[model samples]
Target: MSKWSGVLPRMAITQRSTLLLFALAWLGVCSSFTVIKDGASSLYFCKELDCPKFEEKYNSTAYQIRMYETSKWVSTTITGLDYQAATEEAFMKLFEYIEGENDQHVKIPMTVPVINRIQPGLGPVCASNFTVSFFVPFKFQSNTPKPTKKELFINTLGQEKVYVRVYHGFTNQTNFPKEAADLGDVLNSTQTYDKSYYYTAGYDSPFVSHDRHNEIWFIATDK
Candidate 1:
């Protein structure tokens, strides 16, 4: 009888300790910071001095018209898979670079609205490729740190204007195209845009609620 009592106490203590540790880890992941700069189109991950700013150079709220004067950015491309799979894989690689996995051992501030654009090739529709880009902050744009991995590279994007249709909800493979289609219809009826290419922008973390912000941007036709 005494042998059973000794074993039960240690097992119960261990179980409780494991549960406590799991809870703490979950809370820390959920509590990552999000900082929103004034008059900016997207949110920042933390209070980073060198975070990329999403300046709204033009806004026609009356017609749901918003334009972003995006600054030059360093981006890495991921190819050869479906949209969801490619994005997940590319994000990990980019995250590693920003987490001091680069030539300079630099820790770059994370930015919002991770962008993904479809790269069409001469093949079947389902076999189409996609490119994902993370905007590097302006501070590092001049002398950007090179990624340690060969798959990742840095490139600069000059200032460009994009017309966007913003929405609030989770975006997935099933719903992303539907949202893009809806935005296209509106743009066709009310305004002029470069329909040649359109891309999606996501502005929230995976842990965020269903009411998160996302956008579909059509490169605006020059005025």
Candidate 2:
């Protein structure tokens, strides 16, 4: 059996409180997406928060295929030798923007799976670029608050298909690269993807001690 099998029951019980809060607060916005009928908590890794919606296109022992809708996100970039450090710094800046540090001073609801796109350096010792982002809640997609900080901005992702490999535990510079490399190794040879950069996604808060979900995504070039 796959490692993720039978994990959801335990996760559901543990995350009941948080999941309920997310559904009550954000379910209305996803009315057209069948989140209510399907149970939002079961359908997404972001059980306790709103996340970008996607349609499952395929799944296999190696990876899953998903087609995501065009969405908006609040993002910031940080360049450093340490991926963890740069992600943390960028996250804080984007978090501040969502917490009313913007032109409209509007407090936006936080989202799940803070994603980081990594552009590797040419040399071993060179600093890499990490762009950290939070999904913009559907309600605010059309008119997002403008960030006050020059480093923060709103980014719109066009609809696209991606190959996703899901993993467990906290994602840092070390484990993430390993996971990405492993996923790349196992991908079907016939598949085509963007090799220039990949995305790392973390779906749980630091306080969540178990059932944490992380993923690496390779944009499908053929799609």
Report per-prediction Cα RMSD to one decimal.
9.3, 11.5
Candidate 2 worst ten-residue window by lDDT:
31-40
Model 1 lDDT per residue over 1-223, tens place: 7888999999999867754544443344235433334433333332232334444654553224444445545455666646666776666667677768988997776666577776644554545456667777655666788888887777554455566767777777777777777767765455667655577777666656866877777776664
TM-score, model 2 to reference: 0.80
Worst 10 residues of 1 by lDDT: 40-49
* Clashes in predicted model 2: 0
Q: How many clashes in each candidate?
A: 0, 0
Residues 1-223, model 2: lDDT tens digits: 8776789777777667554544443343233222322323345577645688899998987799999989999888888899866876676577667767999898777667689999898899988889999888766788888889998888998998999999998787689999999889987887789998899998876655699989999998887
Please give the CA lDDT of all the candidate structures. Answer: 0.62, 0.79
Segments of candidate 2 deviating more than 4 angstroms = 1-44
